[model samples]
Target: MTTSPESSGGATQSHKPACPTAEMGRWPASWEQEMQSTVNYLWHTDDLLGQGATASVYKARNKKSGELVAVKVFNTASYLRPREVQVREFEVLRKLNHQNIIKLFAVEEMGGSRQKVLVMEYCASGSLMSVLEGPENAFGLPEDEFLVVLRCVVAGMNHLRENGIVHRDIKPGNIMRLVGEEGQSIYKLTDFGAARELDDDEKFVSVYGTEEYLHPDMYERAVLRKPQQKAFGVAVDLWSIGVTLYHAATGSLPFVPFGGPRRNKEIMYRITTEKPAGAIAGTQRLENGPLEWSYTLPVTCQLSMGLQSQLVPILANILEVEQAKCWGFDQFFAETSDILQRVVVHVFSLPQAVVHHVYIHAHNTIAIFLEAVYKQTNVAPQHQEYLFEGHLCVLEPSLSAQHIAHTTASSPLTLFSMVSETPKGLAFRDPALDIPKFVPKVDLQADYNTAKGVLGAGYQALRLAQALLAGQELMLRGLHWFVFSNMAGVTEIQELKRAAELRSKLRTLAEVLSRCSRNITETKMTLSNLSSELMKNRDQVHEDRSIQQIQCCLDKMYLIYKQFKKSRMRPGLGYNEEQIHKLDKVNFSHLAKRLLQVFQEERVQKYQASLVTHGKRMRVVHETRNHLRLVGCSVAACNTEAQGAQESLSKILDWLSHQLLQDRTKGAQASPPPTAPYPSPALKDLVLHMQELCKEMKVLASDLQDNNRVIEGLSRVPSAPDI
Candidate 1:
């Protein structure tokens, strides 16, 4: 039943022409004749636009609607079985509606000529191949443009596969974009002449398209003309995509071999033997170098293992001389999905920082962060206190990264922290006159001044805490080296050294604190007497006499208050009565001098702090004067004295409150067995006057309360409250 194939320009075999040419002004006979005869038909040919081997395309204007279109006129005379080719192309084009696939407008059979014409949406920017081969982009496609084209082409091919069609020919020449220069890379699949439908078995075997872009297995099957050769699915187009990508990036094909009379054989041999090669600028050899010889080193070494593995199935199949292994679209998409998944956050240790980059995941927790910190610095978990905005982090093992970020606001947050290990003792530990680390060699006042900063036993606990933290930072530099080297356990030994040093500082700090406690006790009793005497003076009812005596007492108390502020005693120069009572023993000898010096100050800070404290309290008393006037104390002189006395009282109360915060525990070691010095009579006399004044004020306040009640009774009914 098979008859002789119709003659195709005296050629019986199917052949690929070199890229079909388009001479701008040359109107071929077939197009010129069709335009002449179809003057009233839908589309009229304008000029020769582009010509492929089997079709000469023309930019045409629709006669009825004036719509511009591309009219692709098939050259039936140049192809055997042209009808079958036309039908397959028409069916495929009509079924596709994807944005990345060229749109078919209409199909027309020209009169008096055995020619079929396709009217398609005109693409002003001709083809992808032209853009890459153009002068400005001679190096290769730009990265962004390449990605756009790649994604668009894959989408188009996927669309075709979904409809059970296979585009056997996929190349830059067949991919084109519309007129806009902005989207020159928004390529669409065109010219489905070589395309065919997949049978119900979902497979296709065809010898079609340009040879260089062909999958080697497909080429081999076509060449051998074997009936039993395996049929491949839609992967042939994906192979073409890989080839297109390679050529676009490097401006050259990967599998070129020596050409001869046995050119086909040489190409096949090289395709099988040669590995793909190209360099992505600045790509370094990874710890594991490139893949084995069977696979090509890709142009980009930075691609994820997912994408790199995808390249194996993609290019590796194209490298096959026999059947090429490939993945379906679903598998391809699965590999590319994780391209954006992995993100990292860098953690650094404090002071001697060791930056360690770790993957940020929903499962990342503080415990994991602590482990990383421990590896960098030998600071133990107990010593690490991570804080942000004065609030300590709840370092729960189960708290996750996102959970922390929810509490904190954003990523890459750095927690400012420090190590605090030493415990400040509250009381004397021993009666021995020797501080653990102290020497009795001090003879000069200048030596004592030097002691104030670091050598002083009073600040030794603070110094030890500072030293331990500083040493921890220094020890971190060797922590990693020690772990991997013969010097292992060095960090532990250094930590032990810090612990021993702390014991000495603990004894000294305790001794200083104990002496401080005794000083506070003696100072408190003096203040109590001064308070009592001042109150008595205020209550005397002899206005000028009582006010003058109270002011005099206040001046002495003011001197002590100013001295504490000037010396920067955050907890002041006193301790709480309860805390002092809890101590086993107090060292009274050091209190007369060492304790007094604890509240002494440098000249400049002393002046500035005293002046500022005086000014601030003065303002507070000035505010009180307005209230004083409200209570019928309208006399200006009375206002000034009352305001001054109120300010002095406030200053003393502030000092007592600050002292409550100082550590005065009884574990202190006695630095020296020095005798307690009794208070000066001048200070005791000032205290006695204040105590007597307090008794007088209490009596006056009681009388005033009784007088107010009687006056209120005279003005109001018995049921009313006293004013």
Candidate 2:
């Protein structure tokens, strides 16, 4: 089954052609004739575009439609089982329908020798590899153009997932770009020749496709006679996308080994099992010399810390060694979408000047409000008394005013007991000084009945309660002010301008609360509904028949007055006031017992629910905090590296300046005449050094800018939430 190079075509026999060339290879006469006939059917012989390993692509006009198309004619003689491969690829292509995937028109068969031609949409820009390897190839593509290409690749992979297909052969060469009307480029995924249609029982048997682009799972799968139980699906496409992105960004493959024939195998093994080597890892110093240089590193280290923090979880999900822990596309997409949206909001909010001002103002207002509330409602009894000392007093009962006044001038013991034993004994003491001592002796009935004590004590309690309520109202107002500040400071100007909208929302909430409060009587009726609902379930606390019986007994006594009035006609049923009061006391006691039971049950349930929710939120906050820590650490590292670079660049500049000055001084000393014909060699060297220093300064400035961008990106990550 193995066809040697000589027998097939000996394509490499000639000085290797930049592209496939028929003149450089030898083919069987019959095979050549079959290819020629197929080409003629698809296109004019003069319009033969190019040739690949086993096919010749040609520009052809469809005879029926008169529309131009690209035809791929496969040489059956070169394929191991050409018919099967072609059918498989055709089946896969026909099922795929996406804007980014190339469209398949029709399949044409040559009558003799079983030659087949695939007709596809014509791509004027040809293949990405061809473009990249061309004479005018540039080092770096524009960011927009790169993103366009990336989007196409992702879109095509998404389509594959939709159709349950895997491309197996994804490479730059297989991708095509077409220029749009406005000079925009549109990329399309083509060549499904090596793709597989996955099924439950079936598994890929062979390790096929280009080595550089192969997934690690493929090699493992090939080593085993039976495929791994866990199949590599869409994640494999994601790996390819990662590699493609790295290539586009850096203009080279991420991992290229530096050794002999075994190097490729080593590199592949490392990719499958180990972390990437020689990644940038920020910056470091040598143990010995002043050696420093900026160079491309593995993406494992080269990726910005902010990006690394994002990628770790993604990689954990995508490249999970454990199948159980791995996230499917749906879960991955949902989590990623949430995180990305949060990150966008955070980044945009960071640089707004109003945000800081609002935050400080809100904090200050909250502190002041809390202090006022604490002072008002948290007053001790002693503090309250001290506040109303001279103005207020509790009413009490006792003797006549003259005796009371005399007793008030002395201490309590001497006042009450002494005055009762000898009423005139304390009369010499000043009345006002001992007033408190004598106040307790007066009968409360007489003292409170008088206008002064009633007005003073009652007024004090009312004023204290009013003040507490006012403090609470001020705290509520402060909340409204803080919310206003938040709305005003939003970085999105249009959103900030929607303060009126927020105020309207607040007004709506107020209206709703007002309506709910007004309908409290109706809402109270629902409390019975709640009780009934609770009673219906056997597991509920109120469900016991004994409890229901007790409730009925209590209900009868609850309406004792009504019952007593109605019982007038029925003499035996009527109860005396003493008996009625006794029933009332029993009813109150039963209600208290029921309330205690309900409160205990509710307390347990509330605690358990609170604990569960608290744990969940704590875990989320912990994860967010860790992510923020990583971001902060990365930013700090970037700043350190930048500082180091700046120092180095500064030292170099200072040295250059000093050397130039020294050279100028030497030149002036060597030249005796004030006006010399020409400057000395030292002076000329200084000029050259100055030019070199300027170039280095420009380079350093660019590096500094990149470092600043990285730092800015890191700073945008949110700080950890307070515990």
Q: Give the per-residue lDDT digits (tens) of candidate 2, residues 1-723.
A: 111111110011112222223434554464454334343333544455555556666666554345567777777543666567758877987898887888887887766666677878777676665554421122323334654776677667667876778776666766777778998877788777667786323445545544455555664554323356545555454445545555554345543444311344644444443433223111113222222222343221223223334434554444433334445655655544433332100000000100000001122332332232223223222221100111112112232212111111011100000001111110011111211111332232222222222222222222222222222222222222222222221111221122222223224223322321232233223333332332232132223233343334334433542333334334242247436544544453354345334322432333234334323322332333233334334434434554565566567667766776776677677875666544466756766776665564444344434433543442232221111
User: CA lDDT of 642 in candidate 2?
Assistant: 42
Give per-residue CA lDDT, model 1, range 1-723, as digits (tens).
001111010011112221112323444565555353233233334355566667676666565455556777777653566567658888989889998898887888667674777778776666777665542243345444655666777778778878888887777777876545553456788878778888434776556765556665665655444355667666677666666766665454545444321354444434433444322111112322332233433332222232333344555444333333345566555543332242344333332222233333456686775665555445565545333222234466667666443321111222222342221211121111112221233222322222222122222222222223222222222221211211111111222222222223224223322322233233334334433432443233223232233233334423432332233423322446324322311222232123223222221223234334323322332232222222222122222433454456456545543443221211123332244233345645555555554444343334333333332222111221111
Q: In model 1, what is the error at residue 395, expressed in angstroms?
A: 17
Rate residue 375 of model 2 by lDDT.
37
Cα-based lDDT for every prediction: 0.43, 0.41
Worst 10 residues of 2 by lDDT: 348-357
Worst ten in a row by lDDT for model 1 = 1-10
Q: Runs in model 1 with CA error above 4 Å? A: 1-47, 179-185, 199-201, 221-232, 258-265, 273-324, 336-723
Which has the greatest lDDT?
Answer: 1
The clash count of every prediction, one per candidate, is 26, 9
